[model samples]
Target: MPIPLPSLDDHDFDDLVGEARALLPVLLPEWTDHNPGDPGIVLVELLAWLTEMQLYQVDQLPQSHTLNFLRLLGGPQWSPPDTGGLDAAVRQSVAALHERHRAATADDYEYLVRTTWPEQPQAAGLPRVRRVRCVAGRNLAGTDPAAAAPAHVSVVVLPEPGGTADTHPLPTEALTTALREFLDPRRILTIRHHVVGPEYVDLVVSADLALYEDAVPTDALADARNRLREFYDPFAGGDTRDGWSFGQSVYLSEVYAVLEQSPLVDYIENVRLTRTGTDDGTDADGIALDAHQLVRLTRVDLVGYDSYGRTHPSTWELPA
Candidate 1:
């Protein structure tokens, strides 16, 4: 008996092609004229069209060559064990197609290079710095006096750098340097640092200071603290906290000192002292604990230097 074929609706196929075009433009901007009227181009386009439709069943191919071409493209998702003899035949056809087209597409070499080159960094200056507390909770330990005590600091900076032209490059560079530092066998603990960019400078830096696991004799901790104090003290002090509070607020202040010294941060702004709390029975004994906190660093209406020298407010919602 002859095999019955699977057919796709014309309108459904068109819709799938349209979706692929829309998605491809954003990621593959150079492939603007992908649908030229050539037999090979048509075959490739049809394969993409089928993929967009989520039609992975191989028996649906209108021609054996179509199945072979898809397999040659390394589309293992479409090739199943049940495909039997069809798989071997497709592979042979695909090998022939490659031999024929290999020389013709050699001229496309330049286009390929241009498309793959990394994007240029966006111009941005240093970022405004702020610090929040890393409160303790279930992740750290059971109820202890220090569990209630704030252990490590949560450094917050703003405006949150999205992969914009300005901030992305700096963070990329900073992340690289940080990873290198982290892998150093001589280094016992991971040192924390912020890579901040200003609206002015196009490049980002490491901001030179490190948050040490233990106090070091060198300038790393001292410089970091001094830089943070200069940026944080003005807004963090005073009515932000009433009467005497556990020196936990000071933890952010110390973190600010580190950021201030960082070469990456251009300046500090909209600095505010916010509180983080936790009810995880394990706290107060200086034992490590995991906790969540609210951060308020930037405000919507304000720009540089508020009435009290606060820069602007940008807040973040972190998971508990």
Candidate 2:
């Protein structure tokens, strides 16, 4: 909806005349007669009529003025036939202006990164941006995660999968360059933005899947592994099933829920989400991820469940 324009002068003729009469005792105390027939009242009404007419003209913007404003927006000329009306055209033009053309806020930077990625000259053969997260006041291009850089903004982006074994995809240097070029022009002059790939915290998860009454052991194991993979998938995995949130910790309970959503598994037990390069993931039940880190499910050990909830290896396989 178009923002309603404020009235320059909201007083009508009657309102102006009433206001002038109300001020008669204060402005001219000696001449206290405010009757309609008084000569002083007649003069005041006449002046009020002229002032109201001037206000009306000032408040009403001409069609040419709207056209000039449209021109100042620097897009194609607005046509009544295409937009249905001037008001709608102005609203759409303003909406587009704020959507991707200007990067005045942290949101604008991230919004532009996704909205303008395919349009960049360098994006000719690059993969689509699957996810984007913006962190203001952090310089992610460097190694220091604790440095305070007030005027800086960092954007972590993940590319769409192109049928690769690498489950976690990173934004290529070309992709980052293209994003920088697209956002640099739209960003505010005082702020600096850095385009970078996502940081992945490698993980090795192991879980026992209890098969349902009709579930095949081999097939169920594969399905269970696949579910776990997609549950932490960079493009479409997380608690909300939309994509994992940045800095989100991986909890053992969430893993259980993701696995249990499948019909092949009756129950899950003894889940271990051990972080790579460490003896155990931050703790026994959770893996702590940095603000810019996402889980890279490098490997998962799937097996049949035992009555005692201990390790039970069965004839299960990951699809080749």
Candidate 3:
């Protein structure tokens, strides 16, 4: 869509004349003959017409000013047209002004990533951005939270779920490289930006819960398991519904709270999180995540339990 030009002045001739007439009561109270035929009213109308013309010209900034704007933008491809007027040049300059080419703030990087790709359609059909999080001061390649990567900004991207992407939807190498190159010129001189795919820590949440007598054991258990999965969702998962925070640790208390919030579950017990492909359940308070790491659910286990020390399967259970 073409960017709309802002109107410099919206006042027309009648508006300007009416304004002047209204001012007469305050500025020149002695003048009572404020009719259309009055000489003063005619003078007011003439001046209003002249002012309206000037306002129209102001809306179209001088040709020289538009050319200067292009020059300030580093003069990418625009040049003064010999045959046609400077309308094309002016349009290009205004469009450039509206384009977000700055990378000073974290938000700028995220916005640029979302907008930069669609404009330059590639032949390989590169992966589209599903979501992105900008993390400042960390090298995602190493992914060490203790390591200080000064002057570095890592953008973690999750590719849209299509176009030959993996089941986890990571961006292809081509797309990553293209995005980095696209942002190089927009970044600050001293800053270096890295574009990389999101690193997700596969985890399984296993728990045993007690349900109210009126609660359906199977249905309640399934709801409790699903609640845990959605709490760490990549797109709509965080506590604020803005996706999970990168580098934010996951605590057992939070997991317990998620299941505890379920209306059917009366209480929760034995909530454990284990990294996928590992036998050791994390007994720590929470799982630590690096600056670029996000949480992904691999499995969920729920079993029925009672205060009387009885345990049985609720809905399903993963093989031990």
Compared with the true structure, what per-residue lDDT tens digits does model 3 show for residues 287-320? 8887678888777878866445556574433222
Ranking by TM-score: 2, 3, 1
Each prediction's Cα lDDT score? 0.34, 0.79, 0.79
List where candidate 1 sits over 4 angstroms from the true fold.
1-250, 262-272, 277-312
Q: Which stretches of candidate 3 lie over 4 Å from their true place?
A: 1-99, 142-146, 163-167, 189-192, 276-284, 306-310, 314-320
**Which model scores highest in TM-score?**
2
**Residue 218, model 3, lDDT:** 73
Locate the minimum summed-lDDT window of 10 residues in model 1.
Answer: 197-206
Regions of candidate 2 where Cα sits further than 4 Å from its true position: 1-61, 73-92, 96-100, 119-122, 164-166, 212-214, 262-266, 282-284, 306-320
Q: Lowest summed-lDDT stretch of 10 residues in model 3?
A: 311-320
Q: Which residue pairs clash in candidate 2?
A: none
Deviation in Å, model 2, residue 268 alpha carbon: 3.2
Clash count of each predicted structure: 42, 0, 0
Instruction: Assess every candidate by TM-score.
Output: 0.15, 0.71, 0.64
